[model samples]
Target: MKSGHSGWVLAIARTLDAYGLSHEDIFRQVGMDPEMLRDANSRYWQEMISRLWCTAVKETGDPNFGLKVARQIRPSSFHVVGHAMSCSATLGAAIHRFARYAKLISSSAMIELTESDDQLKLVLAFDTGDMPVLPETMDTVIAGLVCFNNWIAGENVPPLEVRFRRPHPADAEEYLRLLQCPVLFEQDEDSILYSQTDMHRPVLSADEQLASTLDNMAVTQLGQLSERFSRRVRDCLLQQLEQESEVSRKATAELMHMTERTLLRRLKDEGTTFQEVLDNLREELAYQYLQRPDCTVQSVSFMLGFSDASTFSRAFKRWTGRRPSLAQHNGTAEHA
Candidate 1:
């Protein structure tokens, strides 16, 4: 997670420098040592950064004070990563690329992309560890999305819709001004929605070489989600199911050194059930394996711990409402 302070510190510093504000006066008002900004490495501490941002806005009486600061920095400050995204085939592809390669940019937020029948959604979920204070946190989310979309497309996005997990604050009017969209409050998820028509509007030409290079890297990063769990545990379960190629809940529970009752309870506490985790892991591993033309459906079924190809087929249908082959076909269509 990015330290909340880092975003604020950078914004504040840039804002002060741009407006030619009395650096001493602003720093004192924000209760920050001006010298801290001189050292590029000092911005990692999030709490201090958050405090600096809040103090600056309160003292300066500027709701968009931070954005005003950001306006002054050149797009070139973002380097090659920025250049690559700016040249992406379309805003959708750029966002997808950004979400996949986000660690190269910042660890503060987890960017997620989801597609459904009605709309495509982009979510920038902030880490609880580096929680930004109210308005600034909210502002940053709105501003960053707007700026990113604009920069990539070389035009304004003016998002079609915005939703926030948090309620509207006093400065809600200002948020509307920045987002230039219909802002919904207290929604089920904090996300921005775009029409599918926008997804395929190509901005960067298809470069086989570049796409392949990025795909390999993105998949490698995506695979790290598995590392959070012990490989030994993951491997053991995967191996056990390969022979019989399927196991009941009781069997899996016993193998993991817990009773079925306890396992169910624990998984619930973690905001996931056994079936949900199993399905998620299965889907991910399936995607990984299905990438190879030589990978057979029967072989993939065995690897996923399904008793037989039939059972795997049923499960795959349930997961994606299509057979494995068709799902892969659909995946290709979506990416294309």
Candidate 2:
């Protein structure tokens, strides 16, 4: 399962407390344990994080709930990567480091750094699995980047422009005021733009020797946390299916940045095949979606990327020897 650092969970909890909300209540409401934050190595499931965002937004009734959370983030919120970024020589170097080890922060998303003669862009993309990427999720991520940049620079280093894939919200004044930049919505991608000058500015806390040590540590940690080839393929498939994108073996191979033959050979080495992984993933997700009270067989089928209810039902029977309706009923009982 895709997971994020527990530091983020703690950051959210702190934000909840600041808002006079019970973090315990919020955690329980989303099926997460408050005690999980105590384990520094623990990672929260991506699905639970998504639920927590939705729940927090609903409870706070604040359009800028995400921005509030972003402002609350401490250096600890990013784990070792946070320290690594802080120790980098320049803002550009720090961001390059971040993009390299972004998976250490959250496996469900990626940050890409691109440069033009005058500007650098940090583009944010999500591999959301079956969950939809909420507006608050996007807001917290982009805003947090800005907040951290300013903190490390020891000055307000606002972006040149910010763009979000999400449509315009009901109110954007807070976004304008906090970001202090031209914010555009309904854009092709979610990204932050910084002038090349700001990107090259020296980090106030730069320590070259310590940065080298931290980079070595981060590389070791990243090697330890790397997902297996088959698992990576499954994750790619999940993202494509979740987005209703084209879901062919060729498409999946392209997403993984490998040729079809190479992907096949690697999966074979791992004792799995592309079709097997896809079927297993669909079966797993079928059961998971059935357990949700709000989901029906029709919706679940669509989510599983099946052509129709009958097709999904046949697949379900092949896996569990029962129709989805029966499984849904049993799942509801177990959930209660």
Candidate 3:
């Protein structure tokens, strides 16, 4: 149910413009803010985007609007993910890189790369069951992958088969024509199967060092919009916790390449202090761990940097106004 970036709205606007329709008007029709286009960091509820896609289809009277939308994709539209893809050593490298950082493009969806004896399948799907991308949205995603890879590899890297969850439209001809390969519909999943030969094809623009560098930079930039300063500190703490080390503000600040004062100031601007964010994350994570039947209170305590199981039990009661055992009981009941 995570929100996607503002870039999608702007891309939709450009697509609508081709049909003499106003993208802003369409956005407003869906009760979304057209002003969101101004900030790449701005996001819209996933449901609004579902509505926007439906509205855009009706307004444009184009069954293949999704394909048209795919055509409008520009390299800059994908941000650092695009650059990293372009610099990958081979088409396989590019596709893998794209999958690795696909969340930077849209958190609602994910790209899975699977290998077969003679083929490689790239499956694009909604990672979360609750917020599935609309059928038309999948259309853009499938075609968009083909279009992106073609451009990045400096050739038309058509797939052996393209599968869609939606049924065939009256005008799938355009889709077939644009894809330069077979376009399938009413399939079990949304995917593109590339031949192994195509998978190994060299990316015309490959640069190993530069691609690695851009990926590093992109990781730092992606997902920053939602949590801002708090996310950075949370990430630092998560690393320390994973390493079974104590979390401290000085260590977190140093890991972020910032002074403690500067980190504290930034967190304050986000309406939280570092300790607050850390505890909030810890509490949320604690609840998640406790809700799992296999996790023990003592283990959860250790993960949260508590001195003992009793200390964690008291903190959990304070955070949720109930004992950890009570929460676990409720969770088990809900599942039952």
Give per-candidate clash totals: 9, 0, 0
TM per model? 0.51, 0.71, 0.66
- Rank by lDDT, highest first: 2, 3, 1
The per-model lDDT (C-alpha) reads 0.58, 0.84, 0.76
The runs of at least 3 residues in candidate 3 whose Cα sits more than 4 Å from the true structure, single-residue gaps closed, are: 127-132, 222-336
Those runs of model 1 whose alpha carbons end farther than 4 Å from true positions after fitting are: 1-9, 22-43, 66-80, 128-132, 166-174, 204-336
**Residue lDDT tens for model 2, 1-336:** 677889977888998999999998787655566887997766766877887888899999988888898998777788888899999999988888888888888887778888999999899987977678988888988898889989999989999999999889899999988899999999999999999999889999999899999999888878756756777888999999899987888999899898999999999986779987898688767757887888889888888888888888887777655577876735442211
User: In candidate 1, what are the lDDT values of residues 225-332, reduced to their tens digit?
Assistant: 334233323454555655654555677777878788887776675455677656645764675566566667777787887777788888766654556765452344
Candidate that beats the other on lDDT, 1 or 2, i.e. the better one:
2
Clashes, model 1: 9
Clashing pairs in 3: none
Number of the predicted model whose TM-score against the real structure is largest: 2
Lowest lDDT sum, 10 consecutive residues, model 3, at 327-336
